[model samples]
Target: MNTTEIFLIAILVIFSAPYLVWRLGRTDYWAPLVVVQILCGILLGPGVLGAFAPAVYDHVFAPPVIAALNGIAWWAVMLFVWVAGIELDLHQAWANRRETGITAGLALGIPLTFGALAAAFLLRWPGWSGPNARDWQAVLGIGMACAVTALPILILLMEKLAILREPLGQRILRYASADDIAIWGVLALILLDWDRIGRQLGFLIAFGVAAVLVRMMMRRLGKADRWYVGIIWLALCGFGADWSGLHYMVGAFLSGAILDAEWFELEAMDAFRSVILLVAMPVFFLSTGLKTSWEGGGPAVFAAAALLLLASVGGKLAGVHLAGRILKWPRRETHVIGWLLQTKALIMIIFANILLDKGIITSATFTALLLMAVASTMLTTPIVAPMLRRLGGA
Candidate 1:
């Protein structure tokens, strides 16, 4: 089959699947839309359908499509992070720093410690013949996964449930916003080589200094024009970071955070979010879904996935609950916080891909971690919604 045939077939399947789902009275299903496209790609790739129809999957979902998808994915990620930064109510966060601190401490510290210990113990056990740093990898992976809170999803859930104004909701919002800053910063430091630590810190300090300067400039430019200045600042930040060997997304995030502190207007963010939601983000999610794999492994692979998922979810609940207890939070609030912090997405996949790309982890481990990522996201979404609702109602 030629490229045209492959593309034509892929396009047919993509369009057809949604119509089929919609016809089945499932027009509201985002998961099936993403999942089906991914499964189709797998089937068409060298994996399954490609085994028989080589020209179709390979020539079709080829480098061009893959690259295009990746570009879309990054754009979506930027917009998502942009929304995350904008949604952060800095004034409220400042007022609630103590709660934010306690929540973040419980949410991050316990899971990281437990995960690291588990990794160390498991690496020395039988049948795991990977690297000598198997323990460290496992520990770091768990810590990173656990420390992640789905800021985008959490905010959407909070809004959907009309709990955004509640005290519990407010704290979760504030802490999650603040927590991501700390967690990602820590993950970047831990995951990157030690030699780069000075460079990374220097970049951060420089970014901070630049942000202060930008804020002053924006203030002088008048409040109404700050959003435009903010956008330019964000772009510069991302470009600078990308050029400096750090992730552009982190730069975008910090840029957004700085702007959020300065502008702090939900309406301004709403203006930006319209384009991000309708256009940019779906591409990112679709590409992320496409990169995911769930094939060729047997029971052990699936078992490892299950184990990681359990650890990810269970550890978060326990850790966040502990945070609540330590902070003298009510039981209801504690459970809600536990549920809120359990979802993982982009960073997990990105990190796993990095490790796989760097030859740090085996393909099997990468597959299992991908499975872990999907499972973690699925489990947290529904669970967090109800938990938030319960806390709000209480």
Candidate 2:
């Protein structure tokens, strides 16, 4: 088949296979369509599908097709991250500073500690850390991965559970919002290139000045113009970040983070997010899958994934329980909240992708983190629902 035809075939499989399984199998309770799509990406990756049917995989995912898909995936994830940035409600977090601080701090801190220890253990062996990584870089990167909560996915899950408008949901959003800011700040720290420190510093200084001008212009524009200008702003920030060696997604997040979410209509913002997920994000998931490899062996990858899953879930639960005790939350509230906060999918995957791209983690390590994220997300709804039911509702 021609490049166009093959690209369409790839897209067909990407969108259709996961949707069929998610819809037909009725996995919404445990595995939402997004989670299912991520899993399907792994299954279709070179390690799995290519191992079993190399010819088919090669023919379908030819170089031209992969490149086309990657172009789409790049912009798709950029837009997704930008939306996530805009959705951050730090004002609400500031209003409830004490509660948000204690909850977000413990929830993030404990998991990071546990994950750092796990990364330490992995570093004792071969194939886990990347060639370019320092021991500290490897540990910190993986640690942050464990601590990340997918704020966007959390919103989706809460909406599905019908608690998105509830007080509890609002509280969760505040905590996640605070943590979201920390996650990117830490990412910038990790990506700090002393060799390119001059360039990176220049980028930050320039961005600060540009941000002032951009906010002023945004305030003066109509809503329609604001949306168009936002895209241009996003692209420029992405380019600047990438040029500075900090990576483009960080730039994408900052582009939206500096802007007020209220500038756009809430309904349109929500609809835009959903449309991006439904259409473009599947390609990002597929591209992510293409990068997966079991270079250290499948069994080793699975074992590492299991280990990280334990650290992530156990640490999150432990931290939340401590917070509950301190704040005197109700009996079952901590379990429900912890499970919900443990939901790591898009953001964690994005974090790992950055680490992999920067050569802080090897492909095997990325695969392990990928598996851990899928498992962590799948465990969220089933675990939280029963707890919410027993806790007098979400």
Report the C-alpha lDDT of model 2 over 1-394, residue by residue, as the tens digit: 6899999999999999999999999999889999999999999999999999999999999998998998999999999999999999999999999999999999999999999999999899999998889999999999889999999999999998888899999999999999999999999999999999999999999999999999999999999999999999999999999999999999999999999999999999999999999999999999999999997998999999998998999998888889999999985877888999999999999999999999999999999999999999999998888777777743
For candidate 2, give the lDDT of residue 362: 98
TM-score for each predicted model, relative to the true structure = 0.78, 0.99
State the RMSD for candidate 1. 4.3
Candidate 1 deviant stretches above 4 angstroms: 1-54, 117-138, 194-202, 222-227, 261-264, 293-298, 346-366, 381-394
lDDT value, residue 79 of candidate 2: 99
As a whole number from 0 to 100, the lDDT of residue 210 in candidate 1 is 95
Task: Give the C-alpha miss distance for residue 226 in model 2, angstroms.
Answer: 1.0
Indicate the worst ten consecutive residues by lDDT in candidate 2. Answer: 385-394
What TM-score should be assigned to candidate 2? Answer: 0.99
Provide the global lDDT of candidate 2 against the true structure.
0.94
Which candidate number maximizes lDDT?
2
Query: Residues 79-157, candidate 1, lDDT per residue (tens digit)?
Result: 6676576666767767877777777766776666655554455455443223533456556764565456767666655
